[model samples]
Target: RRYEQRIAAAARRAADRWAGYARTGDQIDLGAEMRHFALDTIWRALTGHPLDQATERELDRIATVVAALPQLPDGEQAGAAVAEDLARIDAVAHAAIAAARRHEDGPDGPGVLRVLLDAAELHPEYTERLIRDELVTLLVAGHETTATTLTWLYLLLDREPGARRWALDAGPEGSPERREAVQALVSETLRLYPSAWILPRHALTEDTLAGHRVEAGTDLLVCPYLTHRDPALWPDPERFDPARFGPGGSRPAHLGGYLPFGLGARACLGTQFALRESVAVLELLLPAFTVRFLDRPAGAVYSITVRPDGPTPVVLAAAV
Candidate 1:
């Protein structure tokens, strides 16, 4: 795949960080490390450049704002609460756009930004503001979701050490079997904590079938996080079992099931990208290191995304 080399490079950079912790026996914040790694991966894919410290520092506010989103007041007041952080995020976005415009063919080659810029030539609607919005969306959605899933994945693996060995034992690194196992791990993680756990939709033209009335103007939310855990759809749904997706695995008997990526036409476009990059990083790190969490959150936090309520600090042990 065109993204294989890029994903590998990003994964290697992340692996190096874990290797450093392994050598020093230092406790690292798993959540922070995963977030950084994910940002770097998506940043490179968007602009063909690695995430530098200065930019990453600014982008860190993305999390702050995202966390506050659920609590913030609606409308104009919402902007006031996160104004400073939004400004910083916007600054970073504009800078990236200008840089991409100047260097359409970046060091790593043309990236998603370049493609957007090229389209602006024929479509005037792709204004600077729109470009910035897209960049910020890709930055937040691309990295944040991936980072959360990975953080959860390792946490789950720590609780179930055998699962890590099971994935590694599926086959050697880069083998199809191993990849499948790694994906299963990610699939399970997402099942438990789906990205954008709750998605809101508006009714343009109301219609209903299950003995319910129709309203032309109404808001509805679809929650994959809830559906993924439905006992009826997923037997023993609370268990973190990846075998549900393995060969000969039995899926929910009901036709409508497992909405991890979501449901219908507007489902996540980056399902494949997210899964691939996740599996890529796991293929490298899972085999190379074992993490012992210094501390685990007492529970999960529900916000723009569902994540561990507290910090995930861990010490890594490199495999012998």
Candidate 2:
């Protein structure tokens, strides 16, 4: 219920932004727009303060750094660069924590930071830096995945009328059934264009998958994009059919094949958060505007996560 409320508030803010821009027939950078909404939501729900313009810019910079790291050369060079970015992010996160602790009396809230702060009091050994690191992890991990998913969802929905109609009939936000429909669309979209398409795992013990033998200490790679479209698992997989998830539609028997958030305990903790966020944004935005991707394949660039090579240049016109 708390997550739902946060999503509602974010949706309202996003809607307002869209309204203001729609009046001028301006092109809104949704990447920036989504970041603003998510940052403000995280700030208020977690730290109890509204995000100021300056903080928003900081958040943008953090995202930019995160989105750029994976593009760096592999090896010690990349490690050093990542350390520098993480240090910067850590500094910002600690500052936020310090600011929150000054005013916060005790933790009795839904924000992850609040919960962690309360734990900090009991476990004094858990330094403020550690708590901040965990909080930063949650914030970056949670919002980045959701933002990318929203980017893909809008880009795909804008091109498919039938998909859009189904999304509307199901009503994307504030409605349970509609939420499920939107979830289906999100699931399908992620299957086709997962933010973390490539997953790397180490073998705990010698095992075999699909008749391939692996040594005890071998590294393994699973590509969700390929597995999701495997003809054996998905019939006519290239087609974007949300109905494949419907009650009567055919779905793969293999559970791990469609892992946008990875599999097992190591899977993303904020998977649900990201999904709900995407659905809420879609519900609010779709009713007010017509979204369509620009005529060009926005190639995926794998950084820390998968995102378009550039701004997912799209046009969102006021829906008449």
Which pairs, if any, clash in model 2? Answer: none
Q: Please give each candidate's TM-score.
A: 0.95, 0.88
Off by over 4 Å in 2: 71-88, 104-110, 171-175, 292-297
**1-320 per-residue lDDT for model 2 (tens digits):** 56677667777888887887877777667666777777666665666555667666666657756765556546997667666766776677878787667655223243667678778999988787789778877777767777777776666675666887786686435677776777788888898888887888999899988798998989988788888889888888878887776547677777876799999979887777777777777777876787655554457776567776677555667888
Model 1 Cα lDDT, one tens digit per residue, 1-320:
76667788899999998889899999889989999988988888898888899999999999989888777756776667589889989998888888888885556887889889999988999999898888888888898899999999988887788888888888987899999989999988888888678988778897894687669888887788888899888899899888888777777866457776776788787788888899989989998998889889988988889999999989999996
- After superposing candidate 1 on the true structure, give the runs of residues whose Cα lies further than 4 Å from its correct spot: 73-81, 253-255
In model 2, how large is the Cα lDDT of residue 252?
Answer: 70
Residue-level lDDT for 299 in candidate 1: 85
After TM-score superposition, the amount by which residue 150's alpha carbon in candidate 1 deviates from its true location, in angstroms, is 0.5
Q: After superposition, how far is residue 58 of candidate 1 from its true place, in Å?
A: 0.6
Q: How many residue pairs clash in each candidate at the backbone level? A: 0, 0
Task: Score candidate 1 by TM-score against the native.
Answer: 0.95
